[model samples]
Target: MDAHPGTEIVIDRDAGPAGKLAMSIRADRAFALGDFRIDGKLAGLHGQAWRLDATTDETTLSSSDLPAIRQLSRADATRQR
Candidate 1:
């Protein structure tokens, strides 16, 4: 996501669930949760924005990345990363 950003992503066993992370997730990015709480970090976060945006309503900006965030399945939500 850092290299090229989109709206969202899904990870099953196919996406290499665990490995040395390849990219940095910006703080603007976030995790989209399922009905239940999940124990994993949102990978490819595209959240590496360390510098804050000017005039960004933090509350609103916090969720701005929602389109790119994906929810974990009920089972995946509880699975440890």
Candidate 2:
């Protein structure tokens, strides 16, 4: 998934629980905002340390509820002030 111009995600279907999913972030910047949903549930990543210079380089996230996700979509969370 291409989150932005310099940020992308690559999923490894076989790396997590039986039906769970795992992914790594490929980003050019030190931080990013990940916003999306899984199985109609909230699964967003924000305000996290995403150092591209670390030994691991990529940031990984896994969730059991992710396995049941059949679609990924984004919603505007902005509201009237």
Best model per TM-score:
2
User: What overall lDDT, based on C-alpha atoms, would model 1 receive against the true structure?
Assistant: 0.30
Query: Mind giving the per-residue lDDT tens digits that candidate 2 earns over 1-81?
Result: 324576666666775457445455566556534444434444444323222334565544333344222223322232212
lDDT score, candidate 1, position 72: 22
Q: How does each model score on TM-score?
A: 0.18, 0.37
Model 2 lDDT-worst window of ten: 72-81
Q: For model 1, what is the alpha-carbon lDDT of residue 80? A: 53
lDDT tens digits by residue: candidate 1, 1-74:
12324223223322233432121123234434222233443333234321233353221212223223343223
Tell me which residue pairs clash in candidate 1: 7-67, 7-68, 25-47, 25-48, 26-46, 26-47, 26-48, 26-49, 27-47
lDDT of each: 0.30, 0.44
Question: What is the Cα-based lDDT of residue 39 in candidate 2?
Answer: 41
